[model samples]
Target: MSKAIMDLTELLERVENDRELIRDLLLIFKEEFPRHLQALRDAVDSMDGEKVAAEAHTMKGMLSTLSATSAASAAARLEQLGRNRKVCEFQEAYAAFENISKKLLLQLDTCMAEVGG
Candidate 1:
């Protein structure tokens, strides 16, 4: 199989190898991700740079915590674009973030399954 998206080994280490906590964290992320995504879409659509920055920042932290480096990087890009008020770049940046976010979600699901969440 291809390399996993999130570094589960690293994540487990960070969580002190608590599979149950990992499962709970993944569940919370799954629950919150959609809402966060919607907020990001709204921020992008409205060209609200500050809002986008806030949303992207939140996502970046979450993704980083999960060891999803690629998605976290995508989110960091969005956060930077928003902070720089690059409205013209929002569409492309958001698209990239969205694509990576989808993959991250799938990876998270796989992780959840592996952890028996």
Candidate 2:
């Protein structure tokens, strides 16, 4: 089988093994992810370094909470690019982050399903 996107074991531990809490968090993430993604896209398109940095930072925190290491790493890269004011690299970095985030969404859906949320 393919590798899991997020570390559910770690995440569950962090949440005190409350599957309901995990499901709730996943639902919230699913609801909010698109808005966050759009904000990041807008920031990137407008070449707003500060906004990009802020958005990426928020996304990194969210992904980290879910134990999505790869997606969090991608967000961190984008955050750094924004911090360094690397507008030229924004598109590439955002694309990579977006790709990982899409997979993360899928994983979250699967997790929610498994938890009966």
- TM per prediction: 0.94, 0.94
**Which residue pairs show backbone clashes in model 1?**
none
lDDT by residue (tens digit), candidate 2, 23-89 = 8888888899999999999999999999999999999998999889999999999999999999999
What are the Cα lDDT values of the candidates? Answer: 0.91, 0.91
Q: What are the per-residue Cα lDDT tens digits for candidate 1 across 25-102?
A: 898889999999999999999999999999999999999988889889999999999999999999899999998788
Q: What number of backbone clashes does candidate 2 have, counting pairs of residues 3 or more apart or in separate chains?
A: 0
Candidate 2 has which clashing residue pairs, if any? Answer: none
- Please state the error at residue 108 of candidate 2 in Å: 1.7
lDDT score of model 1?
0.91
Q: Which structure among the candidates has the greatest TM-score?
A: 2
